[model samples]
Target: MKHPSVRGCSAIVLAAVLTFGSGAVAQAASAPATTPATTANPLDFYITPASLPANNGDLVRTEPSVFYVDPLKTIRAQASVQRIMYRSVNSSGVPVAVTGTVMVPYAAWTGSGPRPLVSYAPGTQGQGDQCAPSRAMATGEEYEGIFIAGLLARGYSVAVTDYEGLGTAGSHTYMARESQAHAVLDATRAAQRLGNPQIVPGGPVALAGYSQGGGASAAAVELAPQYAPELNLKGAYAGAVPADLPAVGRNLDGGLYTGFLLYAVTGMGAAGGLDLSPHLNAAGRAKLAATDNECTLQSIASSGFLNTAQLTVSGQKLSSLLELPELKTVIAAQKIGNGRAPQVPVLLSHSVLDDVIPYDQGRQLAKRWCGAGSSVYFDVTAGATHIGGYAAAIPQAFIFLERRFSNRSAVSNCWLYG
Candidate 1:
């Protein structure tokens, strides 16, 4: 459906975002790593049941939990929290258990109708089981906890997915878009089934995320219609979405964020059951093995700026490896935008100078969505790096959700691109 195009975010918002751009970028580099205190034990909650649930999103288990806004675990959100394991399918269409957290604020819902739910897809937390957001949030170490708190403060219950394998028995399907989408949508389903009076089963829902989370949210939005048609999905906020893996991989080659590229390659390989060992030399194999239990901070600290050529037997960069016939098909299947256009309104934001996740690819996604006649509000910003772009989009993203939940009309800016 073609929604009317309206004016983009005003100049004041852009100026305010720019003011914090540099600081946000600096903060992104040193984002807190999950402390050892949280990972000492193998939590049984993440273990898949011997018998799987028959339906997707059916709750496997639930336990009372906590949420913290700081590393000290002092500042907690004024909400009820639960760590949950639910049924979700993986990329190969096999049923797998996914873990996540569902939080509902204690404050009364002052918004119109039932309180809205934000099915939040979290940005990368690393591939390790201990790096799961549910664990990090309990220890007050989750980097995205602040954003989840923001949603709670707005009286919007939040469901944050750990994605496949993050807290489970297998390797995390890092950039495998379909699996991420399944985890996200099922997280929402699991949240509603928790029987919270504040969050009605068919209540308003919005997908929100940045970076990996952005890609997951984007994928979930595209897949929601067929995967979970009963959801009352309102709109989605996907910022700095890695819509094209090849584009993103090429940009990250030999750069400061090469860790992300490595994560993608290793993750896709694990998810697709491809044996990358043959192509990798000793250094490459060791590097890939290193990520088996490491989180984002560890990966970046250890692997940043290291060229993939040094790790490959053929001395080809990681970007080149993605072009292999077997790998190319896997990566191509992960690409979003060429498939279904979202049925609801979408606020697709990107920074022109995003140091991570190239900008042009994001614009191309917007253009493609527009061509497919989706309701798209393409919000363009300037001078923000990857993290900065995320910081800048938070307020605007929340506002976009507010408008949608309030039943306010969202005008698309798709015409501007044409």
Candidate 2:
């Protein structure tokens, strides 16, 4: 038998790529449930309190929850978990309630000065409330559970954000960078404020995520200095970042991941207050309706190989829809590396063969950040799919976090990229 640690890692990588091929959607239909099937009533903890705390990251409510490595609940993480609702701000600057989970490992912190907290932003979970990470964590269905469990085993506390409107109210502001960044930073704030002895206030911190999460963590690094300046941020590990939304949209237009393109359109429209009725034809609306309720696996499985030209009223592809003046502005707002460098070092990784997100844009983000004098280690992985790209970066990301938390100087390979 393989070691538990090795077995765990293998399971994680396998689950991450569960929907691997072009025909994976058909496989997903027969796959087990990723989201909760049904419920008599919605969990009240997710309900936003009528009155919110004045400050962002202030804890609103919390309840004890369980964290399982698998949906069978046989293998559980050796940690204490809590389902928390915290105050956060949206892109429009409104105070809103956000849901997330905080995990503190059972192991004692022996290596570091204090136990560091990793504010982990998850990749796309979907646009529905049922698909929230907090819910997934409780059910052992979180695709990122393996990575989150890895942090716990290392004696680091992990704070995983569900992002704005993901589990609370309204539509998920997916790919809206500002709101996503705010949620990630504030989740760290809320975790520290939980008053857990293991995770103290003002403790050293870092960010970790990939894909949508990569973009969120990258955005958090850029916004932390000004928005959450008081945070003791050390570094970030961002993998397969969708740094350029337009480029990502183009890549996902008619490919196996067209569902993601639809998600971006719906999510950004919600965040930007755009009425998409005029832009979407009947087919587009129907597709959005299905995509809205799905989790990551289901979304990819059902909407694979769908062409945007078939969905639009004007018979234009999603690439063309992205060119509209209204969408162009909002989509551009989601772009990362806008000349402002993160105050801390970042480990940015991407695969040369990523099928979901284009690789050049990830490289371009590194160049932009490096140009701004940020200490960035661009770890390039070869011949990996989008999920595989992150899997390959996991070891490097962990090493990067280890160095940053140890107060060691981070090495930059910017010259190599140049």
What are the runs in model 1 whose C-alpha is more than 4 Å off?
A: 1-42
The global C-alpha lDDT for each of the candidates, from Candidate 1 onward, is: 0.82, 0.83
Query: Which residues of candidate 2, in runs, are more than 4 Å off?
Result: 1-12, 15-42
**Candidate 1 per-residue C-alpha lDDT over 1-418 given as tens digits, one digit per residue, 9 for 90 to 100:** 0111111122342344435333322222232333322334438677777988889999998888777655655566777788899999999999999999998877789987999999999888777787888878877677766667667767788999999988887888898988999999999999999988887999999999989999999999999999999999999999899998998999998988888888888788977889888899998888887766677777677788997899988888977889989999999998889767899999999999899888887799999899998999888887457766777677678789989999999889999764
What is candidate 2's lDDT per residue for 4-105, written digit by digit as tens?
110112354545544332122221123222333333554777888899998999999887777776666656777778888999999988899999999887
Which residue pairs in model 2 clash with each other?
A: 25-301
Query: Which one is best on TM-score?
Result: 2
- Which pairs, if any, clash in model 1? none
Relative to the unseen true structure, what is the C-alpha lDDT of residue 296 in candidate 2, on a scale of 0 to 100?
72
